[model samples]
Target: MPVLEIETIRGVQLMTMNRPKSLNSLNEELSSALIRAFHMASEDDEVRVVVLNGAGKGFCSGLDLTTVDSIGEQSSRFQALDEYGWVGRLALAISECDKPVIAAMNGIAAGAGLSLALAADMRYMAASARVTTGYIRRALSPDAGMSYFLPRLVGPNRAAKWLFTGQDIAAFEAEQAGLVDEVYADGEFMPHVLRIAYDIADQAPLALTYTKRLLHASFDTDLRSQLRQEFTSIKACFATEDVAEGMQAFSEKRKPIYRGR
Candidate 1:
């Protein structure tokens, strides 16, 4: 069976990490499958948005430790680095994808799983879900872009505290800490997430992609450079057919039908 299950509803691609027996832990197969899935969504013009979640009681429990233990000490260190590098690529792909990615945290997300969630453009977590920087608990340091995404989302100090302690963060606290966008009741989580995804899909695709790029660039760019990018991007958006349709729709008092032009 495929380690990852993919389905599309409307223009939103839903990618589920499938490994319930292991709490959706990352092994080599699952990691590679996930990376490919995101890349596929990014390349597919029909896909306007991506939603990532897991199947089972937990979102993900982190790396499959069994895989690590099989390596000898001399080779384990190098193997570990290579494994994390692959995982990092997956996280980076999600961040850099053209389509906005939303993380639906249905349950516990820890270690690298937390890193994956943080990489998304937005996160909608279930009220019963929890998150943690689980590396410290296992005497491991952060990897899979956790060190990169966590600090950007929650600030350095709070990230430091969490990484240092490896403490479990409840869904409500995560939302308040800016680690999650919103916390929904468990029963309403998927519906709420899909609703937001559909809303985003309703906008001009080119505009949304440009906006996502600009937001990500803001972290590394100065105000002047950012303004220049915004000017260029907005001008490009104006040239798109969707913009014309949008303007016409407003004047006609009807909803715009974007063809992703």
Candidate 2:
């Protein structure tokens, strides 16, 4: 069986991390599988959104420490590629995908795993979930885009504190820090997350894709450029059938029946 399992429900690509025995820790096979899955999702026009989650006790426990131990510490180029290549690819997969990505944090997420969760467009955590920057405690600089993501989301001071101390923050605290969008009780977590994913999948496909792309670009684009880009997108939206349906529905005083044109 594959280390990663993928299922599609209501146009949402559900990617599940399957190594429960390891708390779904990252390893070579899992990383490569995830990269492939993301690429597949990106190419499949039928997939409107993605929902990510882990099975069992945790989302992920970070890198497989034993795997790194087996490789032994080395400064060789091959070692660097072995450790960082897939991580970079995974980051790219998340950043470049037009479809919205939502992470459902069922339990603990640490180090590189935490960075992966942060890459998602939105994150929903179970009340029992916890997240931590685990690199500093293990004498490592942040990788897997943790350095890049942390400061942007939580500000430099909070990111610095987390990176420097490497402490875990519970789900409620993570929500307060803006690292998590919402915290649901374990009993309600999966259903709530699925509902959100279904909601995104129900939107106009082209509009949602363009909106996700524009939002990603807004981070790097200047205000003037973003406005110009948005102007183009807004005009394009008016040409779409879904937008036509929205207008007609409003005039009819009824809920819009968006066909995801």
lDDT of 1: 0.90
Q: Which residue ranges in model 1 land beyond 4 Å of their true spot? A: 69-84
- lDDT score at residue 252, model 2, on the 0-100 scale: 98
Local accuracy of candidate 1 as per-residue lDDT tens digits, 145-260: 89988888899999999999999999999999999989999999899999999999888889888999999999998999999999999999998999999999999999999998
Taking the tens digit of each residue's C-alpha lDDT, what string does model 2 give over 171-235?
Answer: 99999999989999999999999998888887788898889989989889899999999999989
Cα deviation of 17, candidate 2, in Å:
0.5
Give the Cα-based TM-score of candidate 1 against the true structure: 0.94
N/CA/C clash count, model 2:
0
Looking at model 2, residue 73 earns an lDDT score of: 56
C-alpha lDDT of all candidate models, in order: 0.90, 0.88
Best by TM-score: 1
Runs off by more than 4 Å, candidate 2: 69-84
TM-scores, one per candidate: 0.94, 0.92
